[model samples]
Target: MSDYCGGCRYDPKQRVGDHACPYTAGYWSFLARNETEFSGNHRMRQPMQGLHRLTDLDALVDQEKARGSIAP
Candidate 1:
């Protein structure tokens, strides 16, 4: 999953994107769902570091908001 050089559309390296991997999907959901309770821990900070690299962060947040509206 580390390599994006293959034909796989999803990139496990990214935090959020159309080509983001399953880990990102779950990670984003966890973060969004627990935004208030989430803290700046070393473990969380490690993976979240890459989130700053995403150019379309707004779009990713929008996607989370939309998902929240549809969720029960």
Candidate 2:
């Protein structure tokens, strides 16, 4: 609802696809990359569970890897 986000090309609420925010996508990517390590963490339990529910996780991971080092 902020003025700054009104004309932004990226969507903070989205985790994948053309309009996905780099930060949002990166967050999920980071969680996915370290899923095994964070599996045993109680603090990560909810996030991990949410990560598993993303149907586009594989695609998101691929996209993030391809976007490496590029400024979004």
Q: For every candidate structure, what is the RMSD over all alpha carbons to the true structure, in angstroms?
A: 4.6, 3.5
User: Candidate 2, residues 2-72: lDDT per residue as tens digits?
Assistant: 56667889998888789999988999988988899999989999999999999999989889988983233
Cα lDDT over the full model 1? 0.59
Query: Candidate 2 versus the native: TM-score?
Result: 0.81
Q: With candidate 2 superimposed using the best TM-score fit, by how many Å does residue 72's alpha carbon deviate from the native?
A: 18
- Identify the runs in model 1 with alpha carbons over 4 angstroms from their true place: 1-26, 32-39, 69-72
Query: How many backbone clashes are present in model 2?
Result: 0
Instruction: For candidate 1, give the lDDT of residue 2.
Output: 69
Error of 1 at 30 (Å): 3.7
Error of 1 at 20 (Å): 7.6
Query: lDDT per residue, candidate 1, 1-72, as tens digits?
Result: 565547867786764666766556556655655544555676667546555565766666666556563253
